[model samples]
Target: MNTIPVRVVAAEVIAEGIRLLKLSSQDGSPLPTWEPGSHIDVHLDPGVIRQYSLCGSCTDTSTYEIAVKREPESRGGSKFVHESLGVGSQLSISAPRNHFTTSTEADHNLLVAGGIGITPIISMARQFHRQDRAFELLYFTRSETHTAFRDELASGPLNSSCRLLFGLERDAVEATLDDALRNRHDGSHLYLCGPQPFMDTVRAVAARHGWPDDAVHLEYFAAAAPLDAEPQTSFDVRLARSEKTFTIPADKTIVDVLREHGTDVETSCEQGVCGTCIVKVLEGCPDHRDYFLTAQEHAKGDCMAMCVSRSLTKLLVVDL
Candidate 1:
């Protein structure tokens, strides 16, 4: 990924535990254009890169906006951003990448967001509004105090099309989601981003209502649960170009082994949520442990996230 130097133009607390950051080129030039649902990787510190969804208006090329929530048990990224990053701070960021792009073909868009997941959904709502497309936004949060972009969602043009549900129990949230999906019109597409449990419940409700996989789009910031619990089997991996083979132990990752053999692979979010470490699979079956790939992609077995994924077959050959 290419990196660009940017300066923090503004920083403000939008809600409890959430901070909004606006970034721009160091030279005051226009930044790269990005579509809704796009995200950029923030290089917080050496070996600490984290992806943040762009929440600013796509029309505004002068700046990029992202909201960061301080995790209770942060592994450094969020904590640093919240406590250390301030206005005038210089930072490096990757070019914008879109894995959760909006579908322009859909006649209507139903956007659902939970907690900080509102970041991407807000951009989609703005894009849809600008294009005069039919859409509705449903935002769920713990309370009004915890909701980001409250002023914008309440007074902006999208206010009429938005619904705020706060302090709901799990069953209540599920019921609300069921009703939303149950009443969805034909040609309407669903987009969601949120905590794993919330997303799982929403997706489950959509599935129960017969929503096709293509009609539902989602982005995950973290894994639903621990991914290393299963008993791992030792495997062999061959580099197609290098013609080098390595024995991968059950406890080690493919990236670690490759690094040990003097091979370098660009990686971010080693937990497998980011797609930075994906590599092509020339010949063997991959276990498909990453949350970044779709089910169809996993079934194809053509690429794998080397950071946390492994081979399913005894010997896997990859296009190094």
Candidate 2:
């Protein structure tokens, strides 16, 4: 499927370790109203598509802002966004989509961010500030200089009620988190965005402290690692649209198997993070692997991510 194109009209290096990119529509029309936590996948270079959370004000429809952090082990996407692309550059971006959102019903909001994961959390904070809601921000970073948006966050009006946590000087940040989770008031919702290890540590600590499962929400920036268990045995797949059957080996992904059978399906983020490889299912139980789908979408039993998803039965029927 073809995607819409967005142009970079202007970009500014915002704070330390962050670049605020300003994107606009190519035809001079108002961009879509993206709610808080909305993200767009930027199709850069030949085969690199990276998803970045919209860090600009959601109320602004004329343009969007995204903050990019130069990753140490970047595979050219982040470096390209930072060094190569600039003002007046044309880029392909998918429609604004959201997976992480604020729980409106919660009485208090607790936001936790690790390093660059503050992109979406910062948007949520802006929304909260606009709405005059009560919330707390616990931004964790290794050092003050490496943190993004340090000046804006420390001096901004939103910082009046927000708390900044640094792992450099003391253990006060972890103690604060422990105190908040331990002495929770009524209807407190916790939102977490970070790397895999950080998320795991926070989740484990929260669980150990008796935090409710339903109250903990997570936003991941990376593709989920494949399960460590042994691969399944050989299986067969039936494409409902083409009405063709093919066998899938345990060692091969459904995407490779389908393409080998001449199915020209489009895909990116082959690790099952992006929603690019999703397909509908006609029969048989599907083992979904994409991070895009919500818990509700899985219950419908109609869609599957072909990149890492698999069939439970020996013969599975799928809609291409």
Candidate 3:
């Protein structure tokens, strides 16, 4: 991935525990344009890279904006952004990549976001609004105190299309979901992002409402399921390009083994959520542990995330 050198032009708390950052190219040039649902990998320090959605305007090429919510249990990304990163801070970021993208082809879009998940959904909303497309945004937060972009979503033009539900109880939430998803439209699609449990609930409810799997989309900021669910085992991996073979122990991941042997493998969010370390598999069955790939992709058995996925075969061949 190509890295862009940027400087923070503005930084301030957008809501309780949420900090918004505006970044611009250091050379006074226009930043690359990105589609909605795109994210940039922010490099905080050596070996400390985290992905954040581009929540700012796509038409605005001068600056890119991202919102980071302080997560106490995060893998150090959110904490550092909230406490250490500020205006004038220089950082390196990867070109924007989109894994969760919105489509204008859909007759109507249902956008559901929980807390910080609003970052991507808000971008989609902006794009849809600009195009005069049909979209309804459902934003849920603790309360107004914790609601980022409250005034923007509350604008007269968007008031009729967006719903802000604050501190709703479980029953209320379920009822609202039922009412919102009761009827399925011909070309309607649902985009969801939020805490794992929250997304799971939304998916379950959508499934119960007869929404097709292809019509519902989501993105994960971290691993959804625990990788430890499977028992560890030792295996051997061979690189198809170099014809090099290495033995992987039960305690070490493929990435660890490869790097230890001086073979470098790029990785981020080693927990299998980012899909950054995904490589093509030449020949082998893999014990898939990543949420980045779809179920259909897992069934193909042509690739795996080296960071967390293991080989089901004793001898695995990979296209390194």
What's the alpha carbon RMSD for model 2? 3.5
* Error in Å for residue 229 of model 3: 3.7
Model 1: weakest 10-residue lDDT segment is 222-231
lDDT of 1 by residue, 105-165 (tens): 8999999999999999999999899889999999999999999999889887899999989
| Candidate maximizing TM-score | 1
Q: What global local distance difference test value does model 3 have?
A: 0.89
How do the predictions measure up, each by TM-score? Answer: 0.93, 0.83, 0.92
C-alpha lDDT values of all predictions: 0.91, 0.79, 0.89
- Tens digit per residue, CA lDDT, model 2, 1-320: 56778899888876565687999989988888898888888888878888889988899888888999887788898899888989999998877877677888888888888888889998998898889888888888877776777776899887786767776333555566677677776688888887777776677778778767667777778764664144567778888877888898888888798887778887756666556678878888876666656566777768888887777778778876
Best by lDDT: 1
Clash list (residue pairs), candidate 1 = none
Query: Which pairs clash (backbone N, Cα, C closer than 3 Å) in model 3?
Result: none
Across 1-320, the per-residue lDDT of candidate 3 in tens digits comes to 56999999999999999999999999999999899998889999888999999999989999999999998787778888988888889999988888788865798999999999999999898888888989999998989989999889887566778999999987787788888988988789999998888888788889899888778888888876788689999999999999999999999999999999999998767888777789999898988999878777899999999999998899889998
Candidates ranked, most accurate by TM-score first: 1, 3, 2
